[model samples]
Target: MIVIFQYLSIILLIFLPMPHYLRESYLASSMLYSLVCSNSMKSLIQYYYDQ
Candidate 1:
């Protein structure tokens, strides 16, 4: 699911038109979002396994 979202976002980034600074910011935010999502998912999986 996360992979799919990343792919879609990348495609959007390529196709959408915006200022260069805005594009950079969007890329940064998406990277951060994915990092947070991955960390939370890892913790959730570990929690279930530890139960």
Candidate 2:
């Protein structure tokens, strides 16, 4: 939970200073990174189970 909050705060800090046009792109990239990390963690757990 603390790690998630840290990421959210970091994202907010980055977006707060950007122009409206760039905010959407930054948010989309952040979402993509989060998704990739979640998927990778899921796969790692599955691999451990399969071992």
Measured against the true structure, the TM-scores of the candidates, in listed sequence, are 0.85, 0.70
Which prediction has the highest TM-score against the true structure?
1
The per-prediction tally of clashing pairs is 0, 0
C-alpha lDDT of all candidate models, in order:
0.94, 0.77
lDDT of 2 by residue, 1-51 (tens): 746865886778675787776777767876777788889989999999999
- Candidate 1: 10-residue stretch with minimal lDDT: 1-10
- Tens digits of lDDT, candidate 1, 1-51: 879989998999999998999999999999999999989999999999999
Runs in model 1 lying further than 4 Å from the true structure: none
User: Quick one: best lDDT, which candidate?
Assistant: 1
Give the per-residue Cα lDDT of candidate 2 at 8. Answer: 83
Stretches > 4 Å off in candidate 2? 1-7, 10-17
